[model samples]
Target chain A: MGIAWFVVLSAFIFCIGAAGVLTRRNPLVILLCLELMLNAGNLALLSFARAYGNGDGQVFALIVMVVAACEVVIGLGLIVAMYRNKLAIDADEMSGLRG
Target chain B: MIFEQILFFVAAAGAIGGAVGVVVLRNPFFSVLALVGHLLALAVLFLLLRAEFVAAAQVVVYAGAVMVLYVFVVAYIGGIEEPIGPSAGPLRVLGPLFAGVLLVEIAIATIGSGLRAVSSTGPAVADDFGSPEAIGALLLQKFLIAFEAASFLLLIAAVAAVVLAQRRRGLEEAGGETPLQIGRRPPTGPQAEDPAAAGSGGPAGRAIDERTPTVAQGS
Candidate 1:
């Protein structure tokens, strides 16, 4: 298929992830959706790399993966800390910062 | 050419299915598992695009280490699941509606102009175009600073995760006893000598006698 097909697929996946983030109250599920979004971006990057015939996109994708890993780690750690503090785990209930 | 197209479609199906599963599943544990499947499918897509090293990293880092952490956290949280349906009123309808609009907008943008800059069949490439050696060379040459920065970021993330997950001593008392500590109190007076007698005791004695079998059994 053409690169357009790949880009469209990436967009589709990203939208699915966005919907998940918006709809899901569970922080863990939200994180999972974030992962989906990141992966979709990676797919698009790889497709562009293939289209241009180079390794730069691959390298960029690798760095994105590292950053994604860090994000997931910090997110899960926050969730654990919240749980430990006996705070309600629901995203809706995490309003301690609300003015 | 036809084979490649078929493979792409299959992997795309897998990726979309897993993404949907992650969103639709109520249980966070199941959601984590679904994400694992999604990551694996993305790895296949990476391979289809000739990003061999990235595909391997996708499987190893995303599907392997990241998903494992997600699964562990889900398990630790126990049976807690997302409440049925959206927790907020507008979210029930607005969420999907907005997402649909986003999809249409993105699709139009993608189809209209995103691929116009590149040739459909792509440019010719060397055998090592996306190989580990080529990527390594690119990292050392053009992207050395970024590579080093990524490593530094990872180190910070590791330290941060450890610190964030650790229970702060002050908060433990401030938040009151955790579920594990709710019923158990310290051994004092007769209970100090006799583990059977539950104590109206000091926190220090409670800490000391925490492992005592009778105290464990009583709690």
Candidate 2:
């Protein structure tokens, strides 16, 4: 029952996050949305782990946590430098590479 | 059924609302905050599922670290005031259309999956792997290689950031400038008041030689 409830909740959150990533122009917001989706994945994995009485899902979630850390750190470092150079964070204004 | 439906509804609302906030909010900082809220709700949901460790990981890593990095950069870039428009034609239409499709897809998939779960006859109960000890064993025993690989990836990312920063235009230019040049304190002696600095620089600029090192110190 408990795991069942969590599965539903995470799914819902995941959907919302995916939508945000699609609609928002801000790169930072898009990153946040991506994080939300990842959390949803972690949730689903955790629920399954609990339901089947296994530790693998939790371990997978830990790996995911580390990956998430790496992603954000790198992502933010790039964003910081980009913002400093260009004076803007809007994805649209970045036309140096655009055709 | 009745109680589960209610909890599900609350979770869905919180998730959807935060998601909407992430999209609709103009300020990236606010969007990040909404994302934190969304992640928190999902973490609690994970706890409800008996995956206590995953829930904690979600909070510490996603909500705590990832989000802080996001918010900090957003604040640093607060001065970025572009007209704030979509990049291309496709992006303008693409954004809303993608969001709409995702919403519809989630609804259908949720229903389909629930039906499947209800009919399945797999393990009647989940396991203790959601516990910290069980997770540790699985990570160290079965998935150690993958674990090491992820660490290697992190190292690569760190190196890449450094490389990218060094190669970037501003960084390249900044690197060429000495501490004195950066703070507008031109070189002293014969080069002290270079002709270009004397012509382009104002009184304050002319007074900066001794102050360059001090300003760098302050910075």
Model 1 per-residue lDDT tens digits across residues B85-147: 754588788988999999999877776774564438577778888898999999999999999
Tens-digit lDDT track for model 1 on A1-99? Answer: 677677888999999999999898889899999989999999999999999887889999999999999999999998888888778888888967741
lDDT of 2 by residue, A1-99 (tens): 544456655666677677666656567776777877877787777766666656677777788878877788777776777765764565556657532
TM-score of each: 0.82, 0.71
What are the C-alpha RMSDs, in order, of all predicted structures?
Answer: 9.4, 9.6
Q: lDDT tens string, model 2, B67-132?
A: 777767877777233233465577667766775677577656655674444323225444563678
Candidate 1: give the clashing pairs. Answer: none
Tell me how each candidate scores on DockQ against the true complex.
0.67, 0.44
Q: How high is the lDDT of residue B196 in model 1?
A: 41
Candidate 1 chain B: minimum summed lDDT over ten consecutive residues — where? B196-205
Candidate maximizing lDDT: 1
Off by over 4 Å in 2: A2-11, A95-99, B1-12, B79-90, B113-127, B164-219
lDDT score, residue B78, model 1?
80
Report the error of model 2 at residue B145, Å. Answer: 1.1
